[model samples]
Target chain A: MKKIKTANYDICFGIEGYAVLGQYLNEKKYSKIIILTDSNCNEHCLPHFLSNLPTHILFEIIEIEPGEEFKNLEIFTGILQTMTELEADRKSVMITVGGGVVSDLGGFVASVYMRGIDCINIPTTLLAMVDASVGGKTGVDLEGIKNCVGTFSMPRMVIVDTSYLETLNGRQIRAGYAEMLKHGLIYDAAYYDYLKDISNIDFEDLSLLIFHSVYIKNEIVSQDPEESGLRKILNFGHTVGHAIESYFLTQNNKNPLLHGEAVAVGMVIEAYISTQLSSFSKDDYEDIKKTIHNIYEKVQIQADDIEQILSWIKFDKKNYNGNIYSVLLSNKGKAEYDFLISKDLVIRGFKEYLK
Target chain B: MKKIKTANYDICFGIEGYAVLGQYLNEKKYSKIIILTDSNCNEHCLPHFLSNLPTHILFEIIEIEPGEEFKNLEIFTGILQTMTELEADRKSVMITVGGGVVSDLGGFVASVYMRGIDCINIPTTLLAMVDASVGGKTGVDLEGIKNCVGTFSMPRMVIVDTSYLETLNGRQIRAGYAEMLKHGLIYDAAYYDYLKDISNIDFEDLSLLIFHSVYIKNEIVSQDPEESGLRKILNFGHTVGHAIESYFLTQNNKNPLLHGEAVAVGMVIEAYISTQLSSFSKDDYEDIKKTIHNIYEKVQIQADDIEQILSWIKFDKKNYNGNIYSVLLSNKGKAEYDFLISKDLVIRGFKEYLK
Candidate 1:
């Protein structure tokens, strides 16, 4: 059992380690077992999952459609209703077994249902294994606002099994790898250089990357669980990233951006902003830009699109008192938050991206 | 300042003490201020409240029509939307006024909006002042289920000013007092005796009763903030009481029972169950019944109402599996939870209430 201890809980990796789920369930003595998953994972991964678990432990499976579209309150409310119908009490354990959407929505449901119940995260996607599953951040999107309503509540445990990654398509893997790159870019320059050779990495070595990403995030969150200070560094690309994601999600005729894909672009733009305003070296900024451009195709932000994105950013939960705040890299591995970036500077950053 | 400190936070009492809201705001330096109130409080109390605050300190007020009916997700969504439109951020402070509905709904909004903002509760009704405002239990009722969708997130502070009670009608006062009496019945025998001669108590001295009730609740919550053990005692009457409350609230023909009124009846029925099964002395049970009957006007639960209420109890968040569980009194000032009772005995308990 390969186990990593976080400040509050443990993240167990591999089949043998996560198999302790049965042992945990027995010890806790939950009244019932519930598994929340998306349709994709349910068909592709749940069977493999159930086989690995201890036999004779009856559990209910709740499946929703796979996509960011399902990460809304309407779907969330439906799930809560089903849990109520099943008579799921506080003693029941809800295990989320899908990607970011399942982990985010299921975690939010567990945090709020009956003033919160125990939740276990079984991330079936690389993106979730590295990012969403580890952090205590749980939420559902409200009215085109990304994570507008949420809470910081840790899961009982997070199971990181790389075998589930076999079910994912190529784009899904790249989408998840984007967040893994982010972990290195914002925290460890050496790791960032190592991640640049991701194309040459083998599946057997992927678990190490997942562990490293989760460790960085856990260390950040352990210092600031409520996100009052140091944790904002974790949102390195997310301020602009979330706005871009929302723009695509809410608008018609726009191609939807995967969370990590959006953040990849967001990091490039924010890196440019950092070069102009903060002490970030221009050489380092170009390195970040080149690396991101190599992996993610360019997302054109037209003048009209820029206006809408700025509007979305203005209403971002991070900004306060009508001032726009962004977490920008001071250098390749260090970041600073609460930086009051002016609209002109933000527009300039986007214009620079266009060039 | 009459400040009662709980495990996580403090409850400040009196006009002068709670008036420090201005100072607190100044020291904390919130970006903006928003007050959540009901129509009744808006008309009767907002002006007085605004006057008490520091001049030049502006705040936005959002008012909903007062009632338990508005304590649902739809209204909760609307409130979240309004906060987003107003661009309320993590640095903003939300002060909730009115009764249980306002406190519960507002606290929930604050808890989830941008993953939580600072919440200061200025409880306007007696029920909220004593029970709803103190505990971190923030939520909304879901699809006829009471507090099924909620979270245990404490407010930044709770301000108890009895002057708000002057606006409440007599029924509302008694509704709040029911919880106060419950505090005594479960933990303090002397206070229970003090609650018995309610009619003779001076209104000017109401503050003392309010303080005592809050103290008892805070002590219980401090020990078991999550309600897995010692905190279950607070649910002594609430198991049956909540079902009865939900039954009336969901049915069109049945007049909705105020929380404390439903609780008063729940105590009588539960007293009988305790005497029969949990070693509660017959003499104490009779004393409890007599005291409750004298204070609260009888709410007749017809034989027809039993089946539905029973169903409600079975589905309560507190119970698990096929068995119905409740916190039953062992004696006055003592109680036990996870008491598994059969349906036949529950029906007999209701019959005993009717007698």
Candidate 2:
């Protein structure tokens, strides 16, 4: 087992780390258990998880609607109703077993159930295992707004068994891999170098790389658990990435860009802004752009579209005092905070990405 | 203005203290604002609040259905959809301006909106301004379970304008008064002495008592924000109170006990438990019983009802390690924790209350 400790959170990774579930449950002495999952994990992933549990233990499975749109108050109510019908009490524990959406919604449910209850996370998707599961962020989307409702309730334990990755689709794998690459670019250049030959890597190697990526995120989260200072570094690509995602979400014809895909593009564009304002070399900016573009197909950004997307920047969660603050790269592996880049620079970055 | 400071939380009471709303919003630099209210408050209390706002500032109001049944997933979704339609950006703040239900649901909405946003609570009801507004607890009810879905997200500011209580119904005023009596029974003899003549008090004096009650709750909360230790003292009457409340909820009875009403009875019954297990004087237990019976009508507790209520105790939020933990007062002004009194003792206590 790989024992990883960050300032605010500690996570254990590897093959049989799944055992941590039973151990923590025993320690907390929860008598009743409820497992929350989506339709996807209920069929493909939950059986593998259930095989490890003791048969005598009484537990119930709450299946919510699958995907991001389902991550809202409707599904949250469903889980609560299920818990109520099953007579799941305050001593009951909810075990989330799916991707980020499932964990986020389930964690929100547990946090509010009778004002709060203990929960354990068994993240099935790579995006969740490396990022969502470790942090204390639990919430669901509201209407067209993404992640509009949530809480910062930490789980008692997070069991990440990469064995679940075997069933992930190619699109899902690549989407998750984009975030891992981001961890490398934002914090450790050594990891970036390791990820350069991504197309040639095997699944086992991919899992090991994911563990390392989670370690970097875990380290930063532990130090700034509340996202007051160092934790903002984890949102390196998210500033522009979220705006781009929202832009696509508002447009009817274009396919919605996956979270990691949007961030990959965001990293490239923000890198261009970095070269303009900081000591980042032209060569380094090109390398970062080339690395992300190699894996993520570039989306077209027309002049009109650039104007629309720039308008959404003010809506970014990090904005304060009417200024859109972008998390920029001061250097290849270091992130700088709270830079109020101008609208012209944002338009210029979008133009550079289009080229 | 009454300026009171607890160890961690500060309570600013009185009419002009509502200006704290503008200061917090200006300091946080919120670009847009939305005020959440219920029908009751909108008609009776909102004019008092809105007249205080700057004339140039435009704030949207979202009205939700009032009462415990409305505090569910359906309303949570309705509010989310409303916020989305209004284009409530991440920089927008949600100001909850009603009783406990509105504050709880609105705070939960803010905690999850865009993964979290700033929320300010302007509590109108006496129960809300004193008890609900101070704690960081925010949630909605699910099925028959009260506050089953929630998060512990603190508000940027909690504006307590006791002047709103002038419009409260006679029952609403008495309901809030019960909680004040509870604070005295568990932590302060002087406060209890003050509440002895509570029946003769007018609305203006009730406002002063509400401030004092909130002060006691805020002090307890500051010391144990997470409810791990001394905070359990606040649950003094909640154990049996909650069970009785739940029991009544399961039946199709008219005029079910409100939260405060059930708690008033719970205090009486738990006092008997305290007398059995500790240095609690018989005189004090009888006084508690007689006092609550005088203010609130006694509900008949048959043998079958006691068994049903006892069964519900296991589901209490404070339960740990399969053991039913009760917070009992060793005497007035002192509380004992983790007392694992037997079911027989609880039944005996119920019998004592019956006599």
Question: Best candidate per DockQ, number?
Answer: 1
Could you say which candidate leads in lDDT? 1
What does candidate 2's lDDT look like per residue over A227-305, in tens digits?
A: 7677787888788887787788768877777777788888888889989887777888888888877876888778888
Q: Chain B in candidate 1 has what TM-score?
A: 0.97
Give the range of the ten consecutive residues with the poorest summed lDDT in model 1 chain B.
Answer: B49-58
TM-score of each: 0.98, 0.87
lDDT by residue (tens digit), candidate 1, B70-109: 8998898899989888778889999997799999999999
Q: What fnat does each of the candidate structures reach?
A: 0.86, 0.72
For A1-355, candidate 1 gives per-residue lDDT tens digits of: 8888877778998988556887888888888888999888999989988888773545898999998978988898899999988878888889999999999999999999999999999999999999999878999887788998888989998889999999987778888988888788789888888888667788977888888888888888888888889899888888888989999999999988899888887888889999988999999988888888777778878999988888788867779888989998887778889888887887787786766
Each candidate's DockQ score against the native complex?
0.82, 0.50
